[model samples]
Every structure is written in structure tokens, then in C-alpha cells.
Target chain A: MPRQVRLRRHPVGALAADDFHVVDVPMPEPRDGEVLVRNTWTSVDPAIRIRLAAVAPAGYFPAFGLDAPMDGIMAVGEVVESLAVGFESGDTVWHTYGWRDYAAVPAGAGALGALGSLRRLDTAVAPAHAYLGPLGPMGLTAYAGLFDVAELCAGDVVWVSAAAGAVGSLAAQFAKLRGHTVIGSAGSDDKVAFVLGELGLDAAFNYKRGAIEDQLRAAAPDGIDVYFDNVGGDHLRAALSVLRRWGRVAICGAVSQYERDRPAPGPDNLFQAVANDLTLRGFRGSSYTDRMDDMQRDVAAWLRAGVLRHRETVVEGLEQAPEALVRMLAGGTIGKTLVHIA
Target chain B: MPRQVRLRRHPVGALAADDFHVVDVPMPEPRDGEVLVRNTWTSVDPAIRIRLAAVAPAGYFPAFGLDAPMDGIMAVGEVVESLAVGFESGDTVWHTYGWRDYAAVPAGAGALGALGSLRRLDTAVAPAHAYLGPLGPMGLTAYAGLFDVAELCAGDVVWVSAAAGAVGSLAAQFAKLRGHTVIGSAGSDDKVAFVLGELGLDAAFNYKRGAIEDQLRAAAPDGIDVYFDNVGGDHLRAALSVLRRWGRVAICGAVSQYERDRPAPGPDNLFQAVANDLTLRGFRGSSYTDRMDDMQRDVAAWLRAGVLRHRETVVEGLEQAPEALVRMLAGGTIGKTLVHIA
Candidate 1:
């Protein structure tokens, strides 16, 4: 038998561990063109919360059905049985069949699909779990947002919110590595220290310490040219206030308010986009597939050069997946939160 | 003597007639490279209200100081004295020295500078006041917002808010001329009829009649591809709800809530931009100077072909400029409101 996490009920406000159920099920058999994967690691991303609503937010990610096994973003596993070409038994793979101990999926599975298109892992370069963290969609998101969306210029002053989180941490490092000054904001002093010390950001602040605007003003006396926003609400408002003329905002996520029952009021100063000639553009990582090769090359090069680093917070076992997700949403975990299921 | 409108005090909320005081000053003489003009028409634009705030909204239009003669967007006049080349006496000119009877400005003034760079008017195609109405920044705003910002395509379903106002009316007409289905919303029944009957929009609704979301859904059941937003707040929220995937919103104005003392909460569903892959860009007419020649050519051709029509509400005399602005802001005027000054 294999174990998986299923949605017990739709969450009302903040998510609770009880909203998810751990279930034991018969192991799935690999059909033709399918590979049976024994999961090693699974990811817990905050964005999946949008799909947990009773009625999925219109036009967003598809919702999970009640009492059904829920799909998540990333999973690292080993092929135990293979009935598909290009995949062999005992090969390491990464796919989207997450929150479960095992999955039989099409061998071509990529980000959101089955295991058929599953990417073969090279452990010589990095560990298998790295594919679910710094080397995966999280890293690609940071790369595409800063380079492609924000068009980060050399010597630009950049501010990133949620700087200790998966995407924000990478974004800050990428900006710094590209000859730009980086200022980051995090929820706690430890996270702030991690951003400034390990991440080597130009300046870092604990948003929980004081008003984000006041702290941003002090950190970057000269206003920021680009704001990479992850936490919405007041952080967005503060970024809007400090963005210089013709500044750009790459709206990545709204982690702070994603779990709320009601949508939070948007930045009141969004009208500033008109006055300052600013561009506030929202993009998802999936839309930038064309840049994946470039991102993989540059990020891997940076990692080899010791100019970039990766971080993850790991929890043991499939049953702990719900706790990991709740803690990630509650800002209790740093960097990427992953479940070690083997 | 020349009569001009000056600011009595910074408006707190809705503007009052007393907020402006008309004063008579000695006629000015043109310096070398300067031109003196006798104003015949002045434009009352809603955008000017941002300048009336005591503390200017940061990075926006500059605020008007107490007791200082205020400058406005457009005015049509006859050059009475010319000391600069290209501008001759009695030449019809258009400049930003509105709300005044007479003024002397440098001959080389460009946009966002002193009043000297007054544009020479050609009345062969239309009347002089038409320059401050249909052929002015208002019309250009509609043109650029549709073609440049929204990138409106043929057969696209479009929605325009404030559909009976100057820019909104022109935008609806332009979208229709391009073979798109246009739906519009206005504050009053009469305005709705004007949009549907006069503007020939596909469907029109009085936003005051019912919830904007319900009305918009009924009017555009399939969904809208482009949204030309003039009135912000609930109207913006409604548009976000019904905008189809990859829809674009040209954020031209927020006349409905611009005069409020406290900044209004932004659209609750702005996060939809990420899910719907929508683009919401804010732009000012001044940024589209390079498109002016094209706009003039197309608009004139349309006017000549009877494909486009324009409307204006005229209030005689410079002293009535404040009242005109107040009325326009209050949604009491149907189209462009101008003070006919001589």
C-alpha cells in the first residue's frame, strides 16, 4: 500500500492541518507509457492555497475536489517500475505528483503533468531535492521575473519582499550577482539575518520590526528602481511609495494574504503607477518556458562559481505534508518547505 | 487688464466654486522670443483635480499653491503680439495657459514646460473650440489607450466606463470603427441612451440602475477582451471579474473617486491579473506625443467620413471655469466641459 494526502474540507480562513487527511491506498500500477515513482521529496508551496477554496477562484489554478487526493507543484522520486520509453527502472525523476508516497504517471510528465515527461535527475551536480527547490520552478520564477519581466539593468537598486523565502532569496542573489544593489525584507530577525549574512544582500530588514515604508526609506535612502513583490498588502503599498519614477514592479505572489477568507484590499497607491509612469506587471513562472534554458545555464553557472546558494526546510514523511504547508503559509519555515517521503 | 482664475485654497474634498477667485491683472507684454495671446477657450479636465490637493499625490502632476494663478491643460487663443519666429500676430494658437484672458509665454515652450510653445491652430477642418475638445488630449487619450495600451484588435469585445464622457465616448467610437463590439457604462439613463443610440455601442447600461457586475455580465455575456477604464472603484472591480483571459485594461482615469479626501481602496480583485494573464497599464496622454501626427490624420479622416462625432458642454467666461470643473467632476456634464473665454 501507498500513502497520500487528501483534502478533508475546503479551508475557510487560515489553513489548518485538519483540512488535510493522510490516507493509505493500494499502490498504483504503471500502465503502458507510464512509470511508477517512489517519491523521495514533495514540495509545499503557498500558491496552492488558492485552489483549496470551496469554489476555486475563477480562472486561477484548478481546485482540488473534496475527499480527493490533492496534486501539488513538485516531487522528486525514483522510478521503481517503467513501462515507458526514455525512462528506466531505478532512474531518479522529478514531476508534479506530489503529497504522495508513490505515483504511476505518464513518463512525459513535466511541471503539472504525469511522470512520462519526468526530468531525469543528475545527482553529480546537485542533490535530487535541489530540483524541487533552487534548481526548479522556484529558481526559474526568480530568474524570469528579474531578468525577463523587470528587465533588471546593471547598477539598478532592487527591493525584494519575502527575501528569505524560496523565490525572493534567489531573486535577491541574482540581482546582487548581476551588479545591482539588493535590499530585502523578511518576516523575522533570523530570516533578515539569513538574507543579509548568507544571501549577502546589500541591506535587509525585518518587516515585523516597523513600518515597511519607514524601514525601506532608511535602508535605501535613494528610492528603488525595481520592486520584486511577493508579499502583498502593506508591503506592496510600501514598495509603491518608494519606487522611483519609471520604476517597475514584478508582482510575483501575495503570500501574506493568500490564506485569508476574503481578498485583501489592494495597494491604495496603485494609482501611483500613473503618476510615476511605473509598470506593475504580474506574471507566473509557467509563462516563461522559453527562458528556462537560459535560466538553467546562468543559475547553474552561478552555483558552480559559488555566487549563488540554495536553501530548503525539510520535514519527514507524507503525513507531515499538511503541517509543512500550514507552517509555510504561517511564515514558520524559511526558504523552500519540502516533505521527505522516503 | 487680463482676468485669470487663481486658487483660493486647496480643495479638501469635492470642489466648490469659492475655491477659485477671478482676479484682474495688468496686461502683459511679450519679451523677445515670447508671444502674447488673448484666450478664447479653456478646457476643464478632471485630471487637473489632482493638482488641487493640498499635498500633491507624489510623482503626479504638480500641486497648485494657494492664491497662485492656476494653469490648465488646453486653451485656444489668437496671438495678439509675437516677437518669436513662426508665430505671427492674429494667428490662432493652442496652449496650456488656460483659465485666463491673456498671457505672454516663451515661443519655444513644449509640453510640461512654460506656455511659450503654443501650437498653431488650423481651423480649416473644424472650429477652434474643437481643438480643445475632440482633437485635443482627450481624443488622443482615447486613441492611444485603445490602440497603443490596450492593443485593441478587430472583432474584440470592448467595455468602456464613463462611456458618455469625452474620452470614453471617443474610445467607444474608435473601437466600433475598428469592427469591434463595444459595450459601455454611464452614470445616468440619458447618458446610457446617448452611448447606445448616439455612440452606437453594441450594448449600454446605466451603472446606477443595478450592480455593475450584473449589468456587465448581461451586456457582455461571453466576456470582454479589452477594458477602457475611466471610472475606477467598483467599475474596475466589475471589469476585472468579467475580463477574459489575456484581456488588457487601459487605465486612463479614475474620475469617480479622484476628489475624495481619503484615498479609496483599490480594486479587491487586482490579483486576477496573475490568473487571467491580464495586463493593466496606466498612461497619460502626454506620453504619446509621437502618435499625435497619426492621431490627427486618422481622427480628421474619421471626422470627414462621418465615422466620428464629437460633443462639448460650453460655459461662457473664465470665472465659470471652477464651476465647469466641479460639474465635470460631479458627472453633471455629458462630454468635454470648456469655458468659452474672450
Candidate 2:
């Protein structure tokens, strides 16, 4: 028997434990072109909060339907039973599986391959959980946003909002390595210090203590050439105001307004984008799926070379997934938040 | 003697008559590597409205100091005197010049040129002043925002705000020519009708009379693929709500909040951009300077073949420049505004 967390009903606001039901199901044989993966580890993200809102689908995946499994970015266990062509028993993999003990999925699942590695888990270079963090889609997101979209170059000054989060941490490291003067904004003094002192950011600020505009002015006196946006709203406006001529802004997420009942107010300084010849873009990891091989190869090399590092807040057991998600949403966890299910 | 309008003082809000003063002076002689041009026609764009709001030493043009002329896009008379290597005295040319009757500019001013007479002016293809409208950077802003930045492809459905304005009008036409289904919104019933009846937009709405969200929903029953943004604020919010997953938005300009003293409320639907995996971008014409050659060549061809069209509002004389700008700011004009100084 496998325990499954089924979406009993769609949620209207913050997700209650009742919105999902943990049920035991008789193990079934895999059909042709299908593989059963025993879930090992699942990841929690800010986007999961929006999935529970039941308003409309937000972010990279489809809207969740009532009484159905909510599947998204996740890492899984071995193929215990496989009727699929390529997958074999005892082969560990990853897929977009709902919170469950087991999953039977098609070969082409969620951005599993693009998120990180599924074939081999390397604990030496980076922990298996780090595979879901810096070595995963989060890291790839930072790289792609900085290099491919923002066109970051040496000597550019970069600013990052939500600087202590999964993507933000890696982005700052990446930008620093690229010879850019990097500054970050975080919610707490500790987080800000972590980014500046430990992460080696040129400067960092606690956005919670002061106005974003004033903080930005102090951090980037000369102005910003690149703004990697994770928290939208006022942060976006602040970034827009301080952007230099022909600056580039890469919007990977907007965690600040995701949990609100109504949409958050958008940045008010869009006019400056035209006046300063700035470029603001919204991006997703799926768009760069094909580049995973290259991204992983490069990231793996950087990790080995000690150029990048990551921190994780791991929650144990499958039953704790709900709490982990809540903590992540409340901004209680730093870096990447993951649930390890044995 | 040459007559010119000089910036008398920084404007507080809307430019007043006292903000500028026309002065007469002896014509400047052609210096080495310079040409003396008799001014003919010039352009008046919405951007100049902001430039007039403040006095900075080298804000608009470094060469134009205190009590100096304001320079912008212009079409000039023959080169009365040339000292540069590549120019002749009788050559008809265009360059960015001040609001003046006569001027002297460097021969190598990097002005836009006709490619082997490929630049014959057309009236049936587009309104005459469209030479600066869809035929100029306004048109290219549309093309690049749609095809380049937004990466709008064939079969994509488009939603354009400020549909009758300089850039949005051309965007609708450009998208339609590429086999895209186009929907547009305008402030007036007449402009809406013009977009649908004359411009052949698939559907058009009067944004003033109906709720922006409701109108957008009715116009785009199948969801919007691309949003050409000219009016930010509420219009942008509506566009964000209606945009489909993976939709692309080109941030062309924000006419709605252009004149406001403070930044307008942020769009409530921008978070949708992150959730839907949408791409929202802000672009400036100068960033696409490299594409000017290709765009001009193709646009000219499209006009010659009657595949594209534009509109123009000619104010007659340079003295009427202020009024033309006022009309544009008040949303009274439907197309490109040009001032003939000859």
C-alpha cells in the first residue's frame, strides 16, 4: 500500500490541512510507457502558496482542480515497477508528483530534467537536497536570467530583491563571479548580513527596516545596471528608479504579492524604463529546458571549483510536507526549503 | 538671420508659453566637418513633454545649454554649406536638430538616410506624417516590441492598449500582417471604431465606457497571447488578467500615467505574469538601433506594396509645436504629430 495526498477540495485562501487528504492505496502495476517512483524527497516553494489560493493558476504550471493531485517541481525515488520503455527497476528519478509515497508518471513529466539531475545524486559536490537548490532549477534560473536575458557583463552593478532566497542567493554569487558589483535586499538584518558577509555581496540592505527607495539609494549610489527581481511591487519600482541607462531587469518571481487575496499593485516606475532605455523581462525555467545539460555541467563545475555554495532547510517525513510549505510561505525558511521523505 | 526657440526655464508641469522663447540670431557657419542646414520639418513626440519639465545642464542635448534650443528628430533642407568629406552642398538630408529656422550640424551626424532612393514618401500607404509615426521609430517600436522583445509569432492573438496612439496603432497593423488576431482598446468610441473598421482590428473596445477587464474578456474570448502596452495603470491590469499562460507583453509606453505628478498605482495583475510564465518587457528604440536598417527596408517595402498604413497629424508650423504637444498630451491626437518649420 502507498500513502497518497489527494486534493480533496480546492482552497479559497490559505490552504488548510483539510484541503488535502492522506489516503492509502493498493500498489498497482505500471502500465505500458509508465514507471512507478517511490517518492524520496519533495521541494517546497513560494509558488505553492498561490496554487492553494484557488483564484487562478499563477506561475509556471496549470491551475489545480478540486479532488485531484497537485503536482509541481519535485524529486523522487527508484522505479520499483516500470512498464516504460527506458526506465528500469531500482533506477532513481525525479518527476512532478503530488505529495505522495509513490507515483506512476509518464516519461515526460514536470520540468524534472530541467530542474536538476535525476539519474545520479552527487553528495560530494553538492548534497542531494542541494540538487533541488543551487544545483537545481534555482541556480539555473539565476544563471539564465543573468547571462541569457539580462546580458550581464563585467563592471556592471547589479541589485537583487529577496536576496537571501533560493534563486537570489545563487544569483548574487553568480553575478559576483562575473566581476559585477552586487548588492542585495532581504527582510532581516541577519539575512542581509549573510548575503554581504558570507555570500561576499558587495553590499546588502534590510528592506524591512526602511523605504526600498532610500535603501536602494544608499546601496547603489551610482545606480544599477542589472536588477534580478524575485520580490515585485515596491521593490520593482525601486529597481526601476535606480536603473542606469540600458539597464536590464529579470523578473523570475514576485513572492511579495502571491499570498494576497487580490493582486499586488504593480511597480509605478515603468515610464522610467523607456526614458532610461531599460529592459524588464519575466522568465520561466521551462523556456530554457533544452539548455539543462549545459547549465548543469557548468554549475557542477562551479560547485567543484568552490565558486558557488547553497544553504537548505530540510523538513523530515512526508507528513511534514504541509508544515514545510507553510513555513516557506511565511518566509520562515532561508535559502531552499525541502522535505526529506525516507 | 536664423530664428530659433530656446528653453527659457524648466517647466513645472504642463509646458507653458513662458517656458520657451523664440530668438533670432545670425546663422552659424559650417565648421570643418560640418554642414549648414536650412530647417524644413521636425517631429513632436510625447517624450519631449517630460524633457520640458526640468532644466539640467545636459539633459536633452549636451550642446543645448541654458537658454539654448531643444533638439529632436528633424527633416532638414539642403546642405547649404558642407565641410565634411562625404557630403555635398545641395544634398537634401535629415538630422536631429533644434527648433530653429537654420542650423549647423556635423556632416557625419549619423542621420537616417534613404537607401539608394528606397525612401520615397507615400501618402496612400500611410498618412504623410507617418514618416515619423509608424514609418519612423513609432512603427519600429511596435515591430520590435511585438516580434523582437515579445517574440510574437504568427497565429498569436494580440491585445493593444491606446490602440489609436502612435505606437499601438502600428503594432495592431504589424501583428495583423503577420497573421495574428488583433484586439485593441481606445479611449474614444471613434478611435475604437477606427481600429476595427479602418485598421481592421479583429475586435476593438472603448476603454472609457466599459470596465477594462470586462471589455478585454469580451474582445479576447480565447485569451490574449501578446499585450502591446501603451497605457499602463488600469489598462495594464486588465491586460494582465486576460493574458494566457506563457503570454508575452511588450512595454512600449505608458500614456495613461504620463502626465501624473506621482507614479500611478501598480498593476494588480503583474503577479499573473510570474504565475502564467508570461514575458513582460520594456524596450527603447535606441536599443534596437542595429535593427533599424532591416526594419526600415521592410517597412518601406510593406508601404510600397500597400500591405501597411499609418496616420499623421500635421500642426503646420514650428510655432504650433507647443499646441501639438498639448494635444498629444491631452489624448486628442490619433497619430504621429509633425511640425513643418520651413
List of chain B TM-scores, one per candidate: 0.97, 0.87
Whole-model lDDT, candidate 1?
Answer: 0.85
lDDT string for model 2 (B1-342, tens) is 688777777665565656667788888887897778776666777666556655321112222344876765455455787877766766665566647877787754443221111122435544444556656667667777888878887778999988887788888888888888999898888888888888898999998897999989998888898898888788878877888877877877776765666557777766666556666677666567666667777787788888775766777777777677778877788866778776
lDDT per residue (tens digit) for residues A1-342 in model 1? 799899999999889999989889899999999899999998888788888887765777688888886765578899999999989989998887888889987865554422114778887777889877767788888998899878798768999999999899999999998889999999999999999999999999999899999999999998999999898889989988998876888888888878787888887877777777677777777777677778878877887888887778999988998988899888898898889988
Q: How does each model score on TM-score?
A: 0.95, 0.83
Local accuracy of candidate 1 as per-residue lDDT tens digits, B214-307 = 9999999999989999988899889888998778888888887788889988888877777776777777777777777788888889988987
Best by TM-score: 1
What's the TM-score, to 2 decimals, of chain B in model 1? 0.97
Off by over 4 Å in 1: A108-117, B113-116
**Interface root-mean-square deviation (Å) of every model:** 1.3, 3.7
lDDT of 2 at B42: 68
